[model samples]
Target: MTTELSVILAGGGTAGHVSPLLAIGDALRAAAPGVEITALGTADGLEARLVPAAGYRLETINKVPFPRRPNAAMFSFPFKFKAAIDQAKAILTEAKADAVVGVGGYVCTPVYLAANKLGIPVFIHEANARAGLANKLGARKAAGIGVAYASSGLAGARVVGMPMRKSIAAMDTAALRPAARAALGLDEHTPVLVVTGGSSGAASINRAVSASLPAIAEAGVQVLHITGAGKGITDASGALLAGAGYRQVEYVDGMQNAYAAADLIVARSGAGTVCELAVAGVPSVLVPLPIGNGEQKLNAADLVGAGGAVLIDDAGFTPEYFATEVLPLLANAPALAAMSAAARAQGRNDAAEAMAAMVLEGTKQQSTGRHPKMGS
Candidate 1:
């Protein structure tokens, strides 16, 4: 008899966490056609919208962040954590979950602790080189650890390169350009640069790109800019060349088209985004986010160190530099091709399939009464 396979996938608050969770869930669904999947997230996070939209059931937990100030966090931390843990356990139970997989976020913490308490196996996927706080807490504590970067702090971690959307695995780069360009109303002769600030938009990157549109356009390169929600546009279109169109979007539901349209890309170096770029064989100029956890830097480092990308610090992301850097690269055909080749060589598109299979294998082993715990 085939054992029922069900999972409670807990992770999400921001796009950073939610995107990868969806990718993994999508992969899991494709691999196990009969598997049951449910997502756990907070009521207010981006996940509340993204989860159900992706066609998975989403259960909300009551969670609040612990502030750095002892005086402030001390007053409310315990109650918040307890409520979240209780909610997570309820969701896990209701989902009839065989395993709880934490994709990383405050959402992961409660599911992890609850799974630990219930004797339910907890597994975590850490997508960055520098692990997030929640994933770090669950790293050794969980039964299994999967990482996108080999240098991740988890002691028994297996390097499973970050999973991208299913669309990316089969995307044909050779036929991508002309098709994407035609779809976007772009010319076949001009080179294209795709810049995205993620799903929420990047004010700095946008401002810098606007300042350089004229120069970049004059150099025979077009721009496809994906500015997330609430990104107010300026009157920079008049500055662009007639042949070089600047397509600005609030969000891109079809990201495969964006990757397919461009010769090179400029974006924040988050693990999920970088993995997609590598898998698509798209060359990129990675500008790491100057924020908590140094995750963007770590993600970019994984590619740049492998000769798969060009790393740019956020501080030096000036308009002139972008124009100068991008123009020369686009003008040089062989270099662009080489970068694309390197990006493809560094990617593992089969990672999700491999990870899902491995997880199923380990879970089956545990069912036989032999526990598998990672050594920290």
Candidate 2:
């Protein structure tokens, strides 16, 4: 007899956490049409906007907990964590969830505890090469940990590549370009440089790009810049292109088109974005955000070491250096091609399917009260 499955997919705060959630959700839906899936996230994170958009019920929790950092939020954690867990536990009971999948967001704190308390299995997926604090904590109890990198620290962890979005995964280099370029109004003769500061935008990267706009434009290249929502950067006044042909968008809704249109990419080296770039195989200059645990730098270092990308120290990311580093490669097609091949080699196109299989097997095991196959 076939068993039906229900799940609590939990994570948020950033695109890194939320994109994979949707990827896996799509996979699960495709694999098991009758499977019931519910998402748990704070109202504050991108998940608030994305989960429902993906056609799943996203239950809200207390504000996500910040880590060991000292602050008034930290001080109130004891109370908030308790309330969050209670709320999450109630949701799990209502969903009749067989397992809780944690994807490394502060919103996961309560979900982790609630799942364990109810004897529900926890399945965690860590996309970063290094485990985030939340995933590390949750991994200890999870029935299995799915990982994007071989080095991720989760017991029984399978080295599953990060799940990519359906839109991105469907793209083929040859066909994707023409369609994407036409939609963006870019001509084939114009070399395209895709610049982004992630979903939120980077002040430094934007400033540097703006400063070097003239030089970049002189390279006979057109720029597509996603300045982010709050950055308040715009080309409406026509300042960004200023004769240096360009398009400035506050946020990118269709990322596949952007990836397809660009000959080269310049952006932050967040683990999720890096995963996409690697799979897309676009030559890039990785500018890692320097802060927190240096995780972003570590993510960029992986690409640097793999010969897929070049890492630019944030401190040395001046407009002059940007022009110097890119001019040679931009002018040299062979170097760019090699980088693209290398980046593409690093992407595992099957990761999303692989992760969905794992979760499905995990749910089956829990339902049967028996050990599942190792691969499952």
| Top-scoring candidate (lDDT) | 2
Candidate 2 structure quality by residue, lDDT tens digits, 95-117 = 88887888987888788988889
If scored against the real structure, what TM-score would every candidate get? 0.91, 0.93
Candidate number of the best TM-score: 2
Give the runs in model 1 whose Cα sits over 4 Å from its true position.
Answer: 71-73, 236-244, 367-376
User: What is the Å distance of residue 152 in model 1 from its true position?
Assistant: 0.7
TM-score of 2: 0.93
Tell me the lDDT of model 1 at 137. Answer: 84
Where does candidate 1 have its weakest 10-residue lDDT segment? 367-376
lDDT of 1: 0.79
Question: How many residue pairs collide in each prediction?
Answer: 0, 0
